[model samples]
Target: MALNEDLQLQALRLLQADPARSQRDLAKALGISVGRTNYCLRALLDRGWIKIQNFRNSRNKRAYLYLLTPQGIDAKARIAARFLQRKEAEYAALQAEIARLRAEVKADAET
Candidate 1:
């Protein structure tokens, strides 16, 4: 399933913040339901954006940690650029619309 832009960005940010975070911790940090977090994480994993590796914690037992693959880093960079471009375009359009509306209001007031 295609995630909304906000979800995508959130997932990227959460991963960036702590690659070793569990899905539960990530869900809490993102203020999203655990199911949704799991879904998004599954999508990311399927896309090869992250890899789960077994590592021993201080307790010496094996535990899993998520790591961003090289492809994941590239994806993050591309997403960031696209997000910036979209925001810029949206700002420009809103500014033009505001100017147009102001002009119309001024003309109406004069008449």
Candidate 2:
């Protein structure tokens, strides 16, 4: 529900989907700043949720791949479930508000 949690979940999914994407590319996909992406990634790395590996005999020496650890995979699943629950709750609330506002508008028109 918090911004960071959402970002973390999103980042996990993206990395799981494609770890080869550059940080800039990941930022673009997540719709966050590169700085923010780095911050989130560092947090994940520190937590031991993910690990970065350098390629062997690769052209781009600086290029690295992000991989989720076993714990990270489990965390991703849990976070995804929580995010879905939160979003569903938000959707229900918004639908209720829209209905209430529509009733108010109809009442105003009748008067």
Candidate 3:
């Protein structure tokens, strides 16, 4: 299955920590591809969860840096909280499922 909202939140966290990161760098960090990273970034930008700023890099006149806007920071905070809650819920559900499966297996063995 595709990565859930939790992973997306994690991506935001990474971006927040290092706004100057390139798509390739982010992909490497996230264990995804550059293309995928670009896709995710576009989605975040569209949702106003992050932003891109063009600032000249000291090392290269043509190179630019990206910075997060205030709104992006707020959105990251909100999304991070929501992602944590959703992850907790998913974990609980998985635990319950495992318990149910174990019980079913035990019942079958007993029978």
Highest lDDT model number: 2
Give me the overall lDDT of model 1.
0.81
Best of the candidates, TM-score: 2
lDDT of 2 by residue, 1-111 (tens): 134778889899999999888899999999988888888888899888899998777899988899999999999999999999999999999999999999999999999
Arrange candidates, best TM-score first.
2, 1, 3
Residue 67 CA error for candidate 1 (Å)?
Answer: 1.6
Runs of candidate 1 exceeding 4 Å displacement: 29-31, 58-64
lDDT of candidate 3 vs native? 0.76
What's the residue-level lDDT of 16 in candidate 2?
95
Which ranges of candidate 2 are over 4 A from the true structure? 1-3
Which candidate, 1 or 3, has the higher lDDT?
1
How many clashes (backbone N, Cα, C below 3 Å) per candidate?
A: 0, 0, 0
> lDDT for every model?
0.81, 0.90, 0.76
In the range 15-90, model 3's lDDT, one tens digit per residue, is: 8788878778889998888788878887777767776776554565544345566776787678778877888999
- Candidate 2: worst-modelled 10 consecutive residues by lDDT: 1-10
TM-score of candidate 2 against the unseen true structure:
0.88
